[model samples]
Target chain A: MNFSRVIYNKFLSSWMRISITVIILIPFAIGIALLLKSLPIIRSDSIFNLVGSGKWAPSEGKFGFRPYILSSVYVTLFSFLFAAPVSFLSAIYLTQFARGRLIKLVYPVIDILAGIPSVIYGVWGVLVIVPFISGFVAPVFNTSSSGFTILAGGIVLAVMCIPYMLNMLLEVLKTVPTGLKEATLSLGATNWETTKHVVLRNCFSGVVSSFGLGITKAFGETLAVMMVVGNTVHISFNPLQSGYPLPALIANNYGEMLSIPLYDSALMFAALLLMTIILVINLFFRFLMYRAVNQ
Target chain B: MRKRKNIEEKFFKSLSGLTTYSLIGILLFIIAVVFYKGFNALSFEMIFKPPEGGYYYGGEGGVLNAIAGSVYIAFGATLIAVFIGIPAALFINIYLNRMKKVQNLFRYLLDALWGIPSIVYGAFGFTLMLFMGLNASLLAGIITVSILITPIVVRTFDDVLCNIPKGLIEASFALGSTKTETAFKILIKQGFSGFITALLLSFGRGIGDAASVLFTAGYTDLIPRNLDEPAATLPLAIFFQLSSPIPVVRERAYAAATVLTIIILSISLVARYISGRNTFSNIK
Candidate 1:
């Protein structure tokens, strides 16, 4: 009857099941640990004031993080301003206007774009986007500055976000079904009329959701952004200047984080802050996704 | 008014067309620039030898150390992810198959995990390492990356297992097969191809991710001698090399990026081929 083998299988099955449950909770565990680690700083420095203050020198016992928070918000919002319109139009082109073979080519290209590593994107940005902007985009403003500016960050992030926005919007556009488009066309509407009045209208919620996801993508980017965001801690709204976001700051200073008092805790707080913002956005995206799936 | 409507439509059509083509142009431009710059520094010594001087210096070494480190950490992480992820997947798809609501929640949690950025994982990994008083090493990196990829593997495997015809599982149960046995014997075989795809995809993701291991896998010019020893990865190598003010070192950075890109591309292509048309993405 091999009773021992049966017991072993049962043990293995149950143990693995429990292990996976633990595995799934890892992010939460880390999140809670970060909150705890950041507690000293949170207790000493009020989070609101801490986040709103611009002085960030831990060596000086000052922990103002408004600059970083504002940088993140501005860059993400600016990136959305650049990405949404371009990706929206691209999605429209892909689903409604493009030929069949072109659609096939573009879809796989986008999928590959998504799979390409962020470091590669960083490298490409350092060489390509940075150069292009510094040489061309900057000259028009009569500025002679290094290439690693916030505008560079925004442009690179906008490029990185195209796949996220395009893919979701593509799905939304496709889900409009052929019959709806055909009916609109049968009414003697032009392709643009059929699309503007029908396709985009059908996916208005999806278009909004894509913008949300795109914002999240831009906000969470670290390596590519750090490479070209000039890595300065100073906060500013000007895209032409160098500024640091939270993830970029963490990636930049994590190595030396333990060297200063409460520096590690501050980094932890920044991590927690980044995760909270992203998670909130993601939760909203998930709700939208669920709605999209239902529709 | 009718003519204005036509003009407006034409205006939008051209605008969208221009933007779409330009987006494609940007992708093509990135690839072209990477290839052109990277090919200049590509050499056997660049790939085969570890750095002799320093990573940032115009050292006489290749990226062998980083390459081996990436494969090692990714392999270890994938092993852990598979060990934990497959069971989670099986639990969701097999044991709890009837619990539609619970499965949806599980899937939702995984989706959220996917949404968490890699740098945040790096931050979390760094915190854990500091708490444990552990140095950045292959083991710490492996554990961190395992957590990073586990959700991906489970989500992929769950989707794959879901696509397995229910009749087959029912048939196994109808034959008086035990729950675990039926799972191992039927679900595994039915879902084998997709399983491999999930494993390789996550492995590629683990290897390609720099932000997650940026802090956990401390850079080394030498290959890791043991699990506790720090290891370099290709992405970090590229980052350091590119950051160097020296032109030769910057050239090598391009070369390293090319290698990393090729490795990732191959892994993805292989995954696509193995999963075949069930694409898993339907498997879409």
Candidate 2:
């Protein structure tokens, strides 16, 4: 009877501990979910009403985020267009062709770049890339000021996202089994042929996911874009045109919101939109990764 | 025909090699450009003195206050996070071992938090603090940064704790030790190095972060004598000085950037060392 009692007590204690942990973690998790949900509802009246109104007046309590969202998508898409191909090519070369001390030297540089903070990138964008764009790209694109244009911002953002995509591609390439590459090569295929046929084919899903992550990161970035993108609320097809991103809009305006439910709600709604975009991208990447791994 | 194939193979191989070198070259160019711009603006006095006429006054003005504020806030946040995050991670690992679905959910939430952009975190911090009526204070900044870093620490520490050989725990239990005692003494001791590594990584991240602090800790030139007062940090000082219209302020910003970069690089190196040492010792 005593043995049975001891066994029962142990089981009860273990179950109690598990329950306590669940109790603590569940509330914190739910709070985050709740915050995400509240974002869209906050912006329904003023911001959403102004969505097709084409007017953004902060003083008059009128603001529309459609231009900001459009700018974000345009700049992020342009950045991905530039960063994706270069990063993909680089990954292919590094994983397939690089050898010995050269590989050692190259990989660490990429790692350090991956770890560098985004704020530093902001400074670099302001001081270096802004001038270069104003001097060269602005003239070609017929923009007056190059400092805060989408071209300058997109270029800097592309530079920032390159390392992210490259790193992801490298990992996926590394995971490609050695035998597959050797099998292709043994059939009289050249190194380029083997890489193009075997390695690239195998890592296609990873490359797609990496590209998605890059686009998401570019879309979500605020500081670098804020520094160079000129934060105007106008929409334009030209890359040299000035614009604001969703995150920049939230960061710049949220403090001055003056207890206005409309403004606050708009900010929250933009945040909700951004979070949803990020969540969708992350889920898509995870699905691709799982498929790749399983195959 | 065989000779031609060999020649073609050699050409493609060299092209691939060139591509790798160029990729690395781009990274080097970025570092080089930053140094080139920053080096011209660096002066010995900038490190020791404050800005005069919107420029660094070498003899008297120093980044001492900013450095002090950064260390204080970072330490404060790390202390709070360690207290909460470490135990929460342990709870997840030991107690919820049977709940795979819940564990997976927590892992996904943490990853989402990690991936959410820093600006969002800054906005969140701004809202949460203003709502709580703290305004822009050091305590507010610390609280925000602590929340920002907690997920990272929890994830790393949880991984370390969970990877500990299970037999050690079984042995302790077999000797009639309570689960709590076994966890606190044996499992924790075994994972001490990894725990320290996680702490240091979080500390480095908190110290390096500027966006989250920008709104939470409004910039004040005066030395922060209390936690209730707003203070400047290295990153914030660099940012404001760079953006300031004054030429002197611009130079000071560059100097500050150089210093900030060095500090971040050193901390990252130390973190790498700690992680490397822990993995090596674990292997042994």
Candidate 3:
């Protein structure tokens, strides 16, 4: 009877605390596991030098990651550049300006976009954006491009990233006091001036949080980019050129890693690098959030 | 000065309107393009039947195998994630209520983990599977995906739990209810809709992701028979078809995408309905 009573009371707090701690530690555990798996490659080739060289010819047995790293950075950079203005502006419109009918129609659509499978964006990217850019947009810049390129991937990512950034920005923007805008207007500030001076100023940290989330989302994106990026190891600066990014590289090579010596560890190391980057970025945002919460 | 402000307002308004409209335009374009390309290819048999020869190459079959595989893994992963997530969420808000630093630390960790790329989860899961000497099977996929989404579930559920009124908890306790009774019976009951929404959100993510399962869940022409069997998913089905050289097979990729999109759209709609209906359920 006493044992049963102890078992029953365990539900009040003790068991929940233990299990939750274990569950929350899972990602750290996974990260450690990846680090361990990649230990061989990291030990053989220092991470800095491994990513420093520009060649990754597996047949000849070199696994330099300069190209894929460059590709991931540039593609994500371009995606952020393309997505930021549109996402922030639209979020402002959605929160401060949009009215009943427009809100009813547009808001739900944005929510749907958040949940729309990555595969659809990929399919649409492969079908439309790739051909459109390669055929028309590329020539405007005097470059020959294929449907499969980083530019196409960036376009898909911009669309996918917009909904997420918008969600974050909207949440923060809505919290801006209407009275502040009203007071600014009373002081002869125009609507644009009021929003620029008051709303945007107040939501700066949240804006940072949103962009941090966007970078994380775009950086780790695999499938949508994978379908369109011409999966090549060639390291090029031009977005018009097709190349492999880190996540896509890992996805495509994991199956065949066993056939080659040390290929699996290289891929695991890349994943480790990717996870570390995301962790650092998120830490920056969490600092911002902690400030916001304390304030 | 007034004229300058007027011009700025007009310009900025137009800018915001243009970008907002572009967002709507992009969504419509994606839906239109997918439907336009895949409409003719989408048929009952195409959805209901499994591919005959091979999934990657052109074949004379439906996407039944992939559809089944996606649902099985998603449902299984969601079940596991929910069971794990709810307790973790409760623990954060309830068990650690007095320990603000610890609660914030857990939240921060979950958020960081949530940002970890799904492909990284695949890598981690593959490593785990290697240690156990397992093949790419449905079980591996479910485990990896469960890892991928559990943080997300806990974070969102924590949001709901945090909003539960303190008064409700105190009242339950004042009525001589145990902490367990107050948490599960009252707190969870009130947050039920938000909890369901969290589940739906994670489930949709699990079903939609290809990267997390690409290595862990080995693709096949046949549906997964049991947890140990290999599983094919809709995303992989569409991926294999889209990459095909054959035009007919490329069109079929759109069909597969349509199926995936429809499933996600319906799930989101249901979530909205649930959350909308339960707005008044909070303790007054």
Output DockQ, candidate 1. Answer: 0.57
Candidate 2 Cα errors over 4 Å, as ranges: A1-53, A140-144, A259-261, B1-19, B49-60, B91-104, B158-193, B278-284
Those runs of model 3 whose alpha carbons end farther than 4 Å from true positions after fitting are: A1-6, A11-15, B54-57, B280-284
Tens digits of per-residue lDDT, candidate 1, B176-218, equal: 7777777777888888987998899899988889899999999
Fill in the DockQ of model 3: 0.63
Q: What ordering of candidates by lDDT runs from best to worst?
A: 3, 1, 2
Best DockQ among the predictions, by candidate number: 3
The positional error of residue B68 in candidate 2, measured at the CA in angstroms, is: 2.9
Q: What is the lDDT of residue A168 in candidate 1?
A: 78
Provide DockQ values for all models, in the order shown.
0.57, 0.29, 0.63
For every model shown, the clashing-pair count is: 3, 11, 0
lDDT of each: 0.84, 0.72, 0.85
Q: Chain A alone, model 2, TM-score? A: 0.84
Question: RMSD (Cα, Å) of candidate 3?
Answer: 2.4
Which wins on lDDT, candidate 2 or candidate 3? 3
Quality of candidate 3's docking, in CAPRI categories?
medium
lDDT of candidate 3 over B9-81, digit per residue (tens): 9998889988988888888888888888788899887999998876456668899999999999999999989
Model 2 chain A worst lDDT window (10 residues):
A22-31
* Per-model B-chain TM-score: 0.91, 0.84, 0.95
In candidate 2, position A168 carries an lDDT of 72
